[model samples]
Target: MTNARIAALAALGVGALVLAALGAPPLVVAALVAVAGALEVVGQLGPIALRSTLRTPDAVSRAAAAAAALAALVTTGVTAATVCAGAAAVVALGVVWLEGLVGYAWREATRVVERLPGYTAPHSLGARQQVITAGWYLAVVLATLTADGRSGELVLGLAALVVALGTAAAFVLVTRAAIRAKATVTARIAQALRSYDAPVMVYLSGPEGTEYQLGVWLRTLERLSVRLVVVVRETALARVVAGMTSLPVVSAPAMADLEGLQVETFRVALYVNNGAKNGHNVRYRELTHVQLLHGDSDKPSSYNPVTAMFDKIFVAGQAGIDRYAAHGVEIPADKFVVVGRPQVADIAAAAPGAPLRTVLYAPTWTGFNQDNDFGSLDPTGPAIVRALLARGWTVVFRPHPYSLDDARSLAAIEEIHQLLEADAAASGHEHVFGDRASSTMSIVDCFNLSDALVSDVSSVPADYLYSAKPFVITQVDDGPSDAFLDEFPLARASYVARLKEPGSLEAALDALEHDASSSEREAMRSYYLGDFPRDEYADVFGRAVEALVASRCPAPAAPVPGTPGGAR
Candidate 1:
């Protein structure tokens, strides 16, 4: 049978099943099938993005027809089959009324708004439309079946209605033009197969939402090697990742599409988290995954499942290793190495003292949930920064990336700055300002120049443990606000301050500025950032890369059929 015939058969089969499930009588099912089928016909116009303005009338007509079909179903479901004809009329009227309401609402809403055509075109008939149509049809058929007592004629009528309606719906949706063209997938495969001159593989989470630390990591990787290929999502992120890494990058298609790419001698896949969503097979089977995950020293990570798959796991500190172990994430102790974050390492090595010290104030973004009360900086963030500046510290406001990008957040910062400027005593230094060009500065740089670190619950403080400098966390709330720091205990390296209480920030700054001891700094540094071995992570990293290449290149005792031809 032709593809069209198959499509029709599928639709008819589904409709018959619906009839059976609903136990609806014939006429009710027929109306629903028509509505559903009509919408499918309307869908032939193609995507809403490409349609012309003339499709509006057709769209309205289809919406009315579908709505009417639903009304018929409802009436039939509630009433007997003897009244099926009357129920259909009432249902059709209801659809007409809804169509009018929708049309009016659309016009009023879009009156001043310029609507490009095709916006409403695809609604002519789709899955959502069909679902409602089928539901209505089912309701009416059941009512008719119940009223007619499931007689031979009634059963045959219902079955015929189901088939006819289902066939029509299928023909509408699975049109000749709607046939799947495998050419695009084939082209994508071809693209993946092309040989690269020098390919560098970079694995990152979906682009755009990466932490500032990632920027530091990307920059460090590019400086060390030239042929960097970033494996990330397609479209907008490809440009951003390419721009950030300053290297040519390629995104991997689905796992099957990865078959053709030539594996580079230097290619390394990096993992920032232990999540399974990142595709276990693609990273483990096809590439050399370098796990530089994003989580802290809390709880067992998703990394446990695929620990054996990685070439190397770049850990933060002993605490990180201990935490992972405590949580049952098994790492081959020998393979796990403490490569101080390449990004953090770069930040640490930057010229120690800037002309003036800067305070990097960052906070996490409120997630999609309405319960976003947590993780806000003390309302007194600006006031506290002012207090620090009074004692001779330049505050560089770095709100969370989400907050920084949001218009309301930028406006709030501007308002706060104005509040500070209004006070003659507060405007003491040019250094107390938001770094407008923050997109260029890595989070590590923010840490490097900071004389004292001040933040609420953020991974920055955890990272700041490496600096072992005077640190202060605002006790924004008396309660679990400190859970993040308390759980890690690494935060005690810095003085903790309360935000709600008066003079808390001033007092913390005073202690940080005058009373911090070298011993304290050393203890914190050792705990958070372990000492680098041989003074060179590059040599260490290079060696790790070489080891991975050696392991993968030499054929194992037995190789799988689909495995990369073991470095031969």
Candidate 2:
């Protein structure tokens, strides 16, 4: 056996002996060690990585990660000094030997390649790196086995081996299944659906109105030849289809049924974020998922590592590109087309009244490892809201969704209290306020009515930027650190101020009121939205859709919804 593996077994044996001597329960130790080992292995070697062309590391991130790891180890125990020291020495020596072997192998390979033309030689990594990796794996397994070693030898060894092997197999199998299922479902779904001359599908998630608006955008814009087919949550599908006679709204079918469709051909399948998660085998259906985000946030929302499933990304602007890139997210840069803000601007245009001058106070959700500097940054959110109210400036206070106390019916109540308490001693009009509403309602209605917006790194601010409205960004921290640096690149297009000291709220508010002019709004818009030629969004986006759709298997003749025995 390898030295690392042998060391791991030795560590396990030591743990079992220690537990027996201490009169401690072996089962308990085994459970703890198993969990720790699993986590360590997962951290050291990822479960499954989605291959992508876009990959970049953020600076200072590695240092922060190291500090976090050290903190975790310190919190766990200081008594493992001897064991840790021994393990470190072994790991170091193993790594050095591994490096030397790797170097020799590399030299030999180089020689072979130089002597033989058109021959590819093997490349080897350093022994040190290999040992370090192997040692970590062994340590994890040993720790796990030791922790549970009190159980009978046969049971413990068998259980640990089975669990490890089963877990690895499950991960690999599931990934393979998902990939295979994608092609099967896409082909089947394409066959079942009817062919419309102009492909028009309303891809929407969230609530019903958003889907309706998407449908409207496709229908009213005659410049782009399109048909209406609403893709909504299964719950709303029947209602949407029943009301609209000219086209069919395709609700997500049961996964088993999608593999049986005979219909084919679609120009576009506009996919709203989170829509596919609601159903199985939806993405495998071969249409291009044109991802339209629900809101225009500069930060990473839908930007998860799993976003590699998407074939094309419809982003807001260059800010979206930079935010996705800086965070190691893998969206094909070539596949991402800057289509501008689609949903928010349409909402703004539809709002009635004499364009009410309003200021939106939107704070990101605060709870569990979140930055909680709302009071210092805008200790006067309610005061400002009240002041704006007195001045006939309608104010919409949209607190973070998580900020809602369980007892409080709405998040707005607690948010107003947080804002009021900050300046209640002096404002005197703390009790004075208008009727409150949720941020969702405000985003769909009030943001367009507002003349300006006040927010702290909220997506609401970015969505408002689309309207060319004046916006003031609240910086909750004093200076740019690692966390701050990681997020600021996203809002490079917005008007931002890092509130360094206390009592800067009034001045910040004043600056927003005075400075948020059409000129400044236009300048920021020109910088971010200047990339796309306005009229070509559909054509540019449509070509991508066509390629994805045409590549799918042709619909079978008279194919039933499911089963191989059915019509083919």
In terms of TM-score, the best-performing candidate is 1
The Cα local distance difference test for each model comes to: 0.49, 0.44
Give the per-residue lDDT digits (tens) of candidate 1, residues 462-483: 6666555556765555655357
Give one digit per residue, the lDDT tens place, for model 2 in 292-403: 5554454445464455565566666776666667777867777676766544434442232235355666665542344433332234444545555555454566555444
Question: Residue 336 CA error for candidate 2 (Å)?
Answer: 1.2
lDDT for 449 (candidate 1): 65
Query: What's the CA RMSD for each of the models?
Result: 14.6, 17.8
Q: Could you estimate the TM-score for every candidate?
A: 0.56, 0.47
Cα misplacement distance, residue 167 of candidate 2 (Å): 48
